[model samples]
Target: MFTGIIEATGVLKELTLKGGDLALRVQSHNLDMSDVQLGDSIATNGVCLTVVAKHSDGFSADVSNETLGLTRFSQYQKGQKVNLEKALQATSRLGGHLVSGHVDGIAEIVSSNSNGRATEYWLQAPENLMKYIPYKGSVAIDGISLTVNAVEKNRFKLTIVPHTAQETTIADFKVGTKVNLEVDQISRYLERLIQGQSSAASESTLTTGLLAKAGFIK
Candidate 1:
């Protein structure tokens, strides 16, 4: 698991293709790797990758085809900057929301604008994943944990402060830039729990009508 707190911006030094999988070597930048072991997991742009090899300044991980298909990593090129976050330790503070580093889908930046000292970005998410996104909820965009400022249909808005923009790769985002998105884990678990209960409930169906009847909606 990760905290979605980006520790540094790393560079994709190389990508060697082996069959359908890829071996990626990334420059660690300012990320401390002294405690990182060979089997440790690192969240690279919100995708959890296991450390396969260690180097003086970086590490390498193997990327499966399934991960590539679900994330924007397939579009990444050598020298591209990526957000990096080490796995959360038990003693570490929960600075951001819990992130599994499992990319649910890819989202595209539709628009961007300045909001006082912060930059607000409007992104369109995959239609299948829209139900998991909610206004005022948490979403990890390219590994940066941010709050949803607003939600409209399959799109949502996020506001990032200057510090966040400077410390992570989010500052480089532009219109149409693709990003890895991980929705709140709690939402997925709740959906599963509801589905399980609904399967057992005969008249107590679970649907939009049920939500409205329960006063969860107006």
Candidate 2:
């Protein structure tokens, strides 16, 4: 789990594909990786990845084929900047809402504008993923937790302050760029429960119909 509070911007040093999996070598810029150990989970661009190898600059993690296809990591290249955050510790502060570091889907940045220090970003998400993009709701974009400034159908806008821009890689977003998105955990859990109940209700209705058709009900 994570808070979506980005601690630093990291650089992608190398990305190697071996045995149909991705091995990422990154260079942490001012990110403290000393506390990270092998097998530790970390969020890179809002995707929870396990540390396979460690170094002074950064650690390497293996990305499965499913993860690659589901996330924007497939589009990343060497030298690209990425947001980094350590796993949520028990003693850590909840500066942002509950983020699972699990990317639900990718969103496309329709427009990005910066004035002096603040930034305004408008992105279009998938209909299935827009349930959590309510106004003032918590959404983690590329590993940085931000509030929705406004929402329109499957699109939403965000206002990034100077501290967020300077501390994270969101400042590098451009129009047409893709980003990893993690919805609020509360919303996800609630959605899951609602879907479960709906499915159960549908199954019960189907059973009743079957019974009536078989002359069990008059």
Candidate 3:
């Protein structure tokens, strides 16, 4: 798991293609790697990648085809900047929301505008994923945890402070830029619980009418 708090920004140093996978090497830019080790998980642009090799200034990880298909990794190029966050430790403070580092879908920046010291960005999420994004709720965009300022049909707005813009890759975002998105994990679990209960109820004699008769509903 990750806290979605970007520790630093890294550059994609190289991308090597193997059979059906990709080997990624990223150069750390001020990110502390003294505690990192081989086999440790790192959240690169919101996608959890296991470190296969470690160097003085960077690390290498292998990206499978399945992860590539679900994320914007295919669109990345050498020298591109990406948000970087180390996996959360039990003793670490919960500065940001809980992030699985699992990209649910890709979202595109629809618009951007300066909002005084902050920048308001509107992003269009996938139709199916929009249900998970709610106003005032949390969403991780390219590994940076942000609150949804507003929500439209299939889009949501986020206000990025100057500190966030400088700390992460959000400063480099532009219209049409694709970003990896991870919705709130709690919402997903709640949906599954509700759905499972509904399914079980459908098979039994419990119905809305019965509940109303029992004064459970008005």
Candidate 4:
């Protein structure tokens, strides 16, 4: 699990083909790598990647075919900047909402405009995932936790402050930029619970007319 809080920014250094999958190296001068070990997970642009090899200035991880299909990783270019966040520690602060680092889908930036010291952006999410994005709800874009300022159709708005833009790769956002998106974990669980209960209730003998007779409805 991750907190969706970006710890530093990293650059894609190299891409190597390993077997049928791809291995990529990320270099960051600001991120702490002193205690990192093999098999540790790191949230890279909101996608959880396991550490296969550690380096002095960066690390290498293999990207599976499933991840490439669900995220914008396939379109990434060499030297592109990426958001970086280490997995949550036991004593870590809950700075952002719980993020599984399992991106649901990709979202595209529809528009980008300046809002005083902040940058206001409109992004179009996957139609199926739109239901999970509510006004003022939490969402992780490229692994950076942000609040939804507004919502319309399949699009949502995010107001990125200067600090956020400077600390992460959001500053590189532009119209049509594809980003990894992860919705709040709680919403997904609630949806499953509701669906499961509804499915079980299908065998009930009570109906709307029965509810009216019982004074539960008018």
Q: How badly does each model clash, as a count of residue pairs? A: 0, 0, 0, 0
The C-alpha local distance difference test score for the whole of candidate 1 amounts to 0.90
| Candidate 1 residue spans exceeding 4 A from truth | 197-218
Task: Report the error of model 2 at residue 170, Å.
Answer: 1.6
Put down candidate 1 lDDT per residue, 171-217, tens digits, no spaces.
89999898999999987775566667646544333467756665656
Q: RMSDs, each prediction? A: 3.2, 7.2, 4.5, 5.1
Q: What are the models' TM-scores? A: 0.91, 0.87, 0.90, 0.89
- Which runs in model 3 stand beyond 4 Å of their true positions? 197-218
Tens-place lDDT per residue, model 2, 1-218, is 88988888788899999898899987885879878899998889989999999998888899999899989888889998888888999999999978887789999999878766788989999987786677989899998899998999999999989888788886677898888888888865654554466475442232335546656567
lDDT of 3 by residue, 110-171 (tens): 99999899999999998888878888999999999999999999999999999999989998
lDDT of 3 at 1: 96
lDDT of 1 at 40: 97
